[model samples]
Target: MSSTTRILLGLALGAAAGLILAWFDPAHAARAVQFAQPIGRLWLNALQMTVVPLVLALVIIGVSAANDAAASGRTARRALVVFALLLSAGAAFAAIVAPLALSLLPRDPALIDSLRDAIPAQAAPAAVGFADWFTAIIPTNAIAAAAQSAMLPLVVFALFFGFALTRIDATRRERMVEFFQAIADTMIVIVQWVLWAAPLGVFALVLAVCASAGASVLSALGWYIALLCAMYLAVTLLLYPVAVVFGGTRLRRFAAAILPAQVVAASTQSSLASLPAMVESARDRLGQPRAVAALVLPMAVSLFRITSPMQYIGAASFVAWIYGIEVPAAQLAAAAALAVVVSLGSVGLPGQVSFMATTMPVTAAMGLPVAPLGLLLAVDTIPDVFATVGNVSADLTASSVVARAEGSSEPAAPA
Candidate 1:
């Protein structure tokens, strides 16, 4: 069987086993999940271990491989414009649609009380001024930023380093590019090796999560899950039409090209793992120039994250609805803005870890409780598949859009 099939099987069997165990005896299942927690942690750690090195290598190599600073800057500008537009649309969709969908679900007073009880008695986070956020992007120490998994600062530093490399003598620059290319290639190999254990890893991770939460947790959060899935579907369905209309991609062709990558992304719930497939789709299927695909796709893998705004906004809205908190229009706008900024800055973090880091601050900034985030994290695994699929789809679509805009029909000779 294919790896994708195996992953799906693992997810199904794991969730079934966990739910069955939980149904039989919640306490025992929790204990079992606790015992299996290390396996899941190891899998996550293995993936996380590749992130910092992989991102650093990709950014450095991508920038260095560019034709020149002008070309790179133009590409960056176009890609960011596309990313920002799509992200804003997604955020608006989530901010409006999610709350409406959530409102339709019958409220569970018991679940509400449970979530309320879970809230920690802590003060709301201090307001983060615009100046604070701007300064935080340029880290004083790159090492410290990487150590703390501060991906935005790390990315900024990599961009600067990569740009500086472009200004040096050709021979020296080529040597440096070759060095980072080797590192990037090495990390890709490591990722493949790590993913060899994906089925087991996914099984253990889902089993642990399900066993800890039990079937009741699933039932209680069913509506929230439904809302999230709906939002993902809505965004994904909208993406293709946009790609077809504006990007000039054929719908049938786009689907056929992107399906393999989407399958990998859905199964693995990791966009990074699907990067190779996305690049292939962009270059061979969508007819993007090699230079454009190489530059846009790798950077998208680290930075674009098209589904982030929707997911984060939906989560925040759901939390507010559940807690009976009244979020005004102004606060919602602020939350959307914050989510966009955080999503862009969330490069290189593991999937769930990235969600939490980006979402918690929004929750805090909105004056909502962060306690229910644990529960959200528990159930986020299933919806995360859809989210990853959305992200991968957007990545390819954006590449196609940027490539077309650059008027590059044929593959550019490699730098």
Candidate 2:
């Protein structure tokens, strides 16, 4: 079976075991939760340890890549600017939509009990006023921030470091990029190694949760899948209008051109893998100039993922809902900006890796607990289909926008 299936099977079998134990003997169910909690915690720690360094490296690389594009020419610069604005808009959009969507769903008290029961209790976080948050944006000490795991400030340092690399001599800049690239590649391998143990980790985690609250966790999880799928589909449909209005492309023709690429994206769940289909659609169906399509599509795949912000913000919002935290507008705004930055930095990551790597920071930024994320990751395979589709749709739309910006005069192909 595939890795996703293995982890999901682990989730299923765990729920079954936990439910049976809970049904047969409440005493034993409590014991099972106690037994499984430590193992699951260890796995979560393993996933989190990689986040700091991986994000540092990724932010540097992502920023430097965009800077390089900005230097290439006017067209490339415009595309980069457009990509940044679009990513920010998606992040802000999710901040609003996810909370509203969760409000409409039934809140399960047992689900909260299950999460709180599965993990050990901690001291509540102190409230930080707006002044405190604004001051924390630029890290006074980068090393201190990393040690404290202050992701938002540490991310700020990384962003500055990335731009700094662009100003130095070319040879030195090349060396730094190479060095960070090696670190990123090495961390990816480590994360892959950690996830290879995911089935066991998921089993332990879900067993504890289900043992504590039986099947109520299932209801909350169902809400997540449905909500996220709807978010992605909404984003996908949202892009068609963007292509028509901003891109100045015919609506029917744009829709028809992007359909095949969306299909490939849904099946593969990889934008890099879907590149050829996007190029083909852009060149053959949209009638964008070959040069514009070629340049913009690849760049979009690397730097722009419309759903990354949505996923990050959505995961954080779901966690907040589970814990009954009323996320202040201040915190949600911080989370939105954090989501856009981290998502840009970590584009094109594997699903499992991105789920942990990108989502943890936003969760932490919003002051939500990260413990429930392991359970959420197990079910991401379902919504990832729609996430990829949304991404492909955005990629094609971006190409159309860039083509228009470049003043491509090629006559449109038939829908």
Candidate 3:
């Protein structure tokens, strides 16, 4: 079976087992949870250890790639800016909307407590006032921030460090890129290794959580999935307005042209696989020149994935809700920034890898516990499809915007 399938099967089996214990024998449920928690913790730790380095490495590599793309021409530079703005807006939207959505859900204080009791959660760090928090964003020392798991500051530092790499000699930059790429690859290997045990880990975790938290746990997750679906759909639909107003494409024609690419994205669950269709839609249906489509579409596929930031903010907000922590506006804004940075850095990773690698930084930036992430990841299969659809649609939307900006500056056909 596919790894996702196996992990989900494990989740189902564990939840079933736990529910039986909760209903039938409390004493056995207690023992079973004590036995299982450590195994799950170990798996989570393995995954957690990789996050900092992997993010740093990927951010550096992504910066290098984006630098190369921007150097290609004015069109590439404009497109990158558009990608950043749209991603930031989507993330900011999620940051506000997800918490609002979570608040409207039925709150069972007892259920929340039981879920917390299911696995011991780390206490959130003491809050700092705005002055301290704002200054900390620059990180007085990067290594110390990372060692302390001060993700927001460290991520900020990494962004600066990545940009600095661009000013060095080209040969030196190439070497540094190779080095960080190796780090990223190594981290991916470790992630894959850890995930191989995901079935067992998910089983242990779900069993313990379901036993204490009761079947009400599923209701919360159901709500989260539903929220994510609605958010992704909303983002996808919003792109239509963006393309029309900024890209200057007709609404009906843009809709018709993008349909084929959106179908390909939905079916394949891959923007890369949908590229040819997106190019065709851009050139033939939208009347974008072949040259414009060729440049913008490919670059969008490589270095941009709009939904990545949205998912990060959404996950962080959901976790904040589960723990009953009220994230301050400054912290939520910081989480939004972290979400955008990580999305840009880790843009093109596989859904599973990106979920783990990118989302954790945003959650950590918000000072939320990471314990619940594995269960959430197990259930991500449903939302990931829509995330891909939104991403591809955003890609086409971005290309149209770039084409509008570049109007009549180039030939109608590829040189």
Model-by-model lDDT, in order?
0.71, 0.87, 0.87
Error of 2 at 90 (Å): 1.0
lDDT, candidate 3, at 172: 95
- Candidate 2 lDDT over 1-415, as tens digits, reads 9999999999999999999999999899898888899999999999899888988898999888888888878878878877888888788889999999998888878767667878653434567789988998999899999987788898899999999999999999999999998998888999999999999999999999988877888888999898899999998898899999999998988888899998899888899999999999999899898988888889889888999899989988988887777887778888899888888878877888988988988888887788888999999888889998998898888888889888875665654
**TM-score of candidate 1 against the unseen true structure:** 0.62
For each of the candidates, the C-alpha root-mean-square deviation to the true structure, in angstroms, is 8.2, 1.6, 2.2
Q: Which residue pairs in candidate 3 have backbone atoms (N, alpha carbon, C) closer than 3 angstroms, thus clashing?
A: none
Residue-pair clashes per candidate: 0, 0, 0
Ranking by lDDT: 2, 3, 1
Against the true structure, whose lDDT is highest?
2
* Residue-level lDDT tens digits of model 3 in 114-180: 8788876677657778887798799888999989888888888888988999999999989999999
Which model, 1 or 3, shows the larger lDDT? Answer: 3
Tens digit of per-residue lDDT, candidate 1, span 353-378: 55555666566546676545544654
lDDT head-to-head 1 vs 2, winner = 2
User: Alpha carbon lDDT of residue 332, candidate 3?
Assistant: 87
Global CA lDDT of candidate 1, please? 0.71
After superposing candidate 2 on the true structure, give the runs of residues whose Cα lies further than 4 Å from its correct spot. 121-127
Between prediction 1 and prediction 2, the one with superior TM-score is 2
- Native-to-model Cα distance after best TM-score fit, residue 175 in candidate 3, in Å: 0.7
